[model samples]
Target: MSTNLNQRLFNAADSLRSKMDASEYKNYLLGLVFYKYLSDQLLQTVVEQAGELLKEYNSLEKQEKLYRDFLEDESTKADLIQTLKDVINYDIEPDYLFHHLAKQAKQGTFQLNDLHKGFIYLTTNFEQFEGLFDDIDLTSRKLGQDDQQRNITITEVIKQLDEIDVLSHDGDVVGDAYEYLISEFASSAGKKAGEFYTPKMVSKMMARIVTLGEEDRKIFSVYDAAMGSGSLMLNVKDYIKDTRNIKYHGQELNTTTYNLARMNLILHGVDNENMNLNNGDTLNKDWPTDEPYLFDSVLMNPPYSAKWSSDDSFMEDSRFMRYGRLAPKSKADFAFLLHGFYHLKDTGTMAIVLPHGILFRGGAEGAIRQKLLEDGSIYAVIGMPSNLFFGTSIPTTVVILKKNRTDRDVLFIDASNDFEKERNQNKLTEKHLDKIIEAYTDRDFKDKYSYLASFDEIKENDFNLNIPRYVDTFEEEEPVDMAQVGAEIKEIREEQKQLQKELYDTISELTYSKEDEDWIKGALEVFKYED
Candidate 1:
């Protein structure tokens, strides 16, 4: 059912693929899908709560008609709206419900203004959903050149979506389907995908590392300073025993992506009270300065090699002051790392994805790497294959950090060659991910694949964390047999001579003139035996 759901949702929105860019079209598709989910969920919740009141027409097939009938009663209408507000913290009018709108669309009576008003009502009255639909511009010419054309386009989408019964599925089917759509959009968005998506395989690996031993904890807190779509932090939820107790904290620099993260978390069943998401620059400003600033697990996949202000005033900030030097303006890789690390609890684990340059690049980044090694905060460096991400093809590494670690060695796993190539991108299959997780958790040496480098070994190389320096993945070429090679060459030469003689005899018989015969013999002479 979920498989078909994913396909239906994608196909429904794919009708507009030729009309606009994926990056732009995603806003409309995801926004409308979320609206349908909310409306359907609300209707189901109300039906369940007002069981006796709705018992007469409670059949699933008649749900929309029954809802309309129930809301028509003036006495029950106000009560229903009030009850919904008290229960779900918001209410949508019967006329604006997804079922009503979809019905109108099917009957060719849907208006773009009606949907716009619905969105405005939710964004204005619902604090949780405020600004959520800001990216979905109903008035944009991209939808169509004229309002009627736009209505026709949107109405067609609504009719297609009406085929899926969101209320039919149980237990995260809606959320899982939503995630599938996001991933599909990311694939279509190409380089723009970096703004709001992280490849699921990489997110899974980081989640496993950070939640290694703390699965049984009563309460676990996670943070991603440069959280993109909040998928990285949500992956941690899958590993925890009680996902409800896992508090999510994230800050995204992109406003659209910030809203995307919020919708993603909520769609995945995260409670509003459990999320601490903010839209702002993580590097220039420090957040979560209030109580419980630190987290038990800090995971990040910030934009690689991005520019930052690197202002002198930040030197006095607590997050950067300890490092003694700022991450350069051209590359804020270490800047994001330090921010996440500063918010990591002493007993917590931090995992971050960065470019390979952070391993050995000199200047401020080098100095910071040396200090981290000296303090034993660096735990493991796992090099990943190139083209694993959506946009970039450069090989990247995941550096795991921990506070107050007893181990003085860094585990280096050369997973650069571990991925399976798919189309234009390299993918880390489940088998490959499992292998990396095993190496990271066990911290044991595997020849040519992973190496446990001691503090002294690192010092010998001037604190360079390059994977090749530690894990020797070079396989010796197979030894060549010179005697066999020479014999084969002789055999090839004899065969060539036989063919040449055969060709010379055949050409001699076909020759009609002395000049032709000489030319043919000369051409054949070039293929004669040579030492």
Candidate 2:
């Protein structure tokens, strides 16, 4: 069933790619898909209530006449819209309905202007309401260079998506389709993928490690500093059952991705008010700057090695001020680390993926590491396999920080070799993730795999957080047997002697026979005497 749905969805997406670029194509197609999802859900609720009303009215003597009258009544239509608004948790006017648009599209009269107006009408009507089509950009470049192209592209995309039942019991089907498109675009977006989309396995590991051994009903708030499409933040919802109790918050720098994040949150059925998507740089200007805000669970896969202004002005910034030095203008890994650390609540746990350089870089980074370790907030550092990301092959580490750690020692798991190699990419399977989580939860110090480094020990190493320095993953060679070695040496000597004899025989035969050996010796002697 998933295969069939995927094929149909892919075909629909492929049909519109010619009119737009792959990256832009995603936004356009996904916006229409989300619109269809909202419309379908709203229509389903209305139809169900309509059916109930018709059943009740059918008990009268003029049952058929009453049903016809109710269907045609304007007040009944208004009530249906009201019920739809209330039940679906969003306002969907009749004109914005997917079936209505599909009908117009099939009749060849649904022009781009009409579709754009419908989308605008949808958002404007619901602007005062709770859940609205806040992310769909009618003027987005993804639609086309101009109105004509954009309309054609959107109309066809909507027509194709309108064929599927996106509001079925398997309602996540629409989200799954959207995720497939996200993964496709992420591959082509290169480093930009890190901004919004985290590898699924990495998100799983973060969510699993943070929620280890705890009941799904445990109330907690999950946040991400760079919540690209809000995938990482939303993945936590799947890991936990009582997600309604958990509030989702995130800040994205890219306007497009910020919009995507909000759309993704709503499409996944997250209450719009519960999920806060902010646009702007998280390090410099925090959008949702509610003082001392902290989360119970934080997971982030920020851009690897991004550059930022570590100028003197930012020295006074609270996120970096406490460190006493700025991260180098060339590398912002530590900057993100400090930000995540600051937002960590006293009872919160945060997991972040960073380049290995953060572990051993000298100067300002070193001082920050020293402070983090000294404060006992650094919980565990697990080394992940290489090529786990979309654009780069560099191995990354997941540093788990906790404000309320039971142990003073930090857990280090050398999971560098724990991955499945498929094609050209390395993936963390369920087993690999489970093992890392087990070691982290149990705080096990397995030989050659994990170690518990104390604060003093880390300080003794001058605060170098390198994994190899703490957990010696090197394996020693086995000792050789002396007696067997000596016997093998003797056998080699005898074999050399026989090989020399055979060589001498072959050379002597090629030059002169044994009978000419004496003659050659006598000639050598005579020549020496003459000299």
Candidate 3:
């Protein structure tokens, strides 16, 4: 039954993709998925409420009448209405729920104007819950060249999503499906994929590392500068059971991706009020001005080698003011690092993925690296293998920074050689992530895997924090076998002489036709006559 349902859902999505691009199809699919989630939640809430009323009237003679009266009570009615409002306020409208949309679609009366109105209704209803549907562009060209085609595509999507019982089934499956769609869209989007998504394994590793040893206590807050699809911030929730204590904060540069981040958070059951997503260039424009704020845990997998403004005006900005020199416009790796570092609380720990260039790049980046190390903020640097991301094949590294540390040494894990290649991409499996995290947690310096470099040693290298300089992952070649090599060379020379004689004989046979029996003699006579 599940297989049949899965096939039907996929087929519907495939048909929609035939009419629209993945980027456009994503809005329809994910928007409907969000719609289904709210509908199921609302239906479930109603059923639960109805069930409680029935239970109360089980022994009453006029049970039906009593139950009806119970539902009509002002307080009960208000509660039900409030519940519907709460769910709708989170991007689902009572009238435009999946079931309702499906019913309308079935009758063939659903029009593009209706769907647009439904979207507007949802946004208007949830205006208090900002950023919920900010990423879903209903009118984007990716959906269709015109409104009619988009409406048809979306109607089909609504019909398909109406079949899923998201609220009744296991929550993880629905969340996983949403995540799967996000990943699929990211892969198709190519370089743009990096704007909104991080591989699940990477997010898991970062979440695990940051939440280590604090399984019992709740993380106070979590933030990501490049939230993308909010996957990294959402991932931290998977590591712990109680997320009520952890508040999520993120800022995204892309409008579409920022909307995705908001949807992703809510799709995973995060309350709209708990997660804050701002759309703007995080480096230049710092949103959410509530300051003196600090997070207990932070994780980021920012774009690699992205260009940013390094104009003299930015020197006066608070994020770069302390650093003295702004990160060069060509490389904003350190700029993100500084932003994350500045936002980190005294007890918070941050792990960010950066291009390997940031480790040894010169000029302003180099100065920033030196100052960070000197301040004892860097904790560990883990080298990830190349081709780990979808767009680029360049190897990357994770720099773990901390506001407080007991040790002055930086732990370097040369995980560049540790991944298992799957198809064209390299993956860090659960076991691999576990091993790396275990080494980090234990602070054990295993040969080839990790190394603990002292502060003085790092200073000797002029504060260059490149992983290879500290983690010695280079393997030594076997000692040379001179006698064996020499014997092999002598035998090769003798074989060469025999091969040369055989070649001469073959050449002479081929060249000597019936008329030219001695080609060498004929050639010599011709040369003498010419002289």
Candidate 4:
């Protein structure tokens, strides 16, 4: 049923392709979708808890007795809303509910002011709902120059979203559709899109390796420093089932994307209490500061080679203080990694996506790599295929880190050859992703694909951890058969000599064997072999 539901939602998104920019449409449509889910979920809770009262009220209304008579003295509306708040931590008034607005829209009587009031009310009542609708503006000049046109456009999207029964199932239905919308928006958003989007296939692989043995653990926590749209963080929860023990912590730098990450978490059904998300610069001000960086699993996909302050004062910051050298100010890849690593629990595992430069770049980055290796913090390096990302085609690598592992060797997986071309971008199919997970799980050597490099081997090359330096994927050329080549050359010369004689005889027949025979032979000499 949800398969069809997802299809319907995507088709609805396609309806707006010509209406606005894909990125802009995502904000408008998904905000409506989120609003719809919230309103729908509230009504669903009311139905389950107050069905008897609602039915009685409806029966009374049909018999010429209005709802006022049934609820005049009881304050039934307030009672019901407070009841919902006790359980769901939020409430949507009757007039502002999705079903109510949907009916009004069908009759062409819906008011944009009503929705605006509702959104304002949401923030005024609950802190978590704040800024969710900030990115979505109904009165924006992009929507329309006048209120009437804007109302028409807004009504159409609300009606379309209302068509989706977000509360139809108890699974991640709404969240899955929400993720679909995010991915579609990112595909058309260009380089800026890479900031918040990590392919689900790659997320799955990272989830698997990070949560390998902890899948069934009753209590577990995962963190992503650069949370982006929170997809990577929530994706970590897909593997663990005991939600009671699940703790999610993350921080995003971009305010718009940060709001998106927060909405994504709630839409996916993760409770507010379970989430510890923050909107701040992870490098300058670390979130989860109260928790002291002890997550059981840490996942990150920070922008490649992003810039950071890298001030000398950071030399004293615990995350970088131990490394002996901070990452270059021009490239803060190592800075992001070390921040996540610092917060990781001794028993935790982390997987991060970074460019190949981190493996061999000299100066600060190289020193940091050497310190991590000597301390046995580096676990495995998985080379991803080029073009796997949307905007940039540069191939990236996923480096797995562990705080407590005793293994002194790094697993080098040359999975750069394992993706399929999808239109313009490269993607890791399930088969390709699964193979990487298997190689990582087995941690055994595979010819031409994976190699287990020891600590001494890394030290021998001056700590250059480039994949090609370890895993030999080179193919040897086949030796040529010189004797067979010589024989073939002789055969060709004999055939050429016979052809020349036949030509001479044909000429003799045409001229009665007397038409400038020597001249003809001399002219044909130009065609003879140089040797």
Candidate 3 similarity to native, TM-score: 0.79
How large is the C-alpha RMSD of every model relative to the true structure?
3.7, 8.9, 7.1, 7.0
Q: How far is candidate 2 from the true structure (C-alpha RMSD, Å)?
A: 8.9
Q: What C-alpha root-mean-square deviation, in Å, does candidate 3 show against the real structure?
A: 7.1
Model 2: per-residue Cα lDDT over 1-531, one tens digit each: 556556656777776666566666666666676777676665445546666553444322233233344547887856655675676666554555666777677777676666666677666676422233444566766667887766666677667777765655253554466556655554553445545666778888898876664446567688888887777777777667787776888988877677767767776777756766667898776445683267777888899889998889988877788778888888999888888777877877789999999989998888888777877889999998888776678999999998756665788999999889866567889898788877887787888889988878888888888999988877788898999999999999778767666655555455667898897666544433210
**Which of the numbered candidates is closest to the native, going by highest lDDT?**
1
Give me the runs in candidate 3 sitting further than 4 Å from their true place.
1-13, 18-20, 52-79, 86-95, 103-109, 128-150, 168-188, 404-406, 477-531
TM-score of each: 0.88, 0.79, 0.79, 0.82
Model 1 accuracy (lDDT, Cα): 0.83
- Residue 208 accuracy (lDDT) in model 1: 92
**How many clashing pairs per prediction, in order?**
0, 1, 2, 1
The TM-score ranking, best first, is 1, 4, 3, 2
- The TM-score that candidate 1 achieves is 0.88
Best by TM-score: 1
Model 2: pairs clashing at backbone N, Cα or C within 3 Å = 196-228
Candidate 2: segments with Cα more than 4 A from true spot:
50-72, 103-109, 128-151, 163-165, 168-179, 182-187, 213-219, 239-241, 404-407, 475-531
**Shift of residue 382 alpha carbon in model 4, Å:** 0.8
- Candidate 3 local lDDT, 351-419, one digit each (tens): 999889988988898888887887788999999889777667889898899976766789988888878
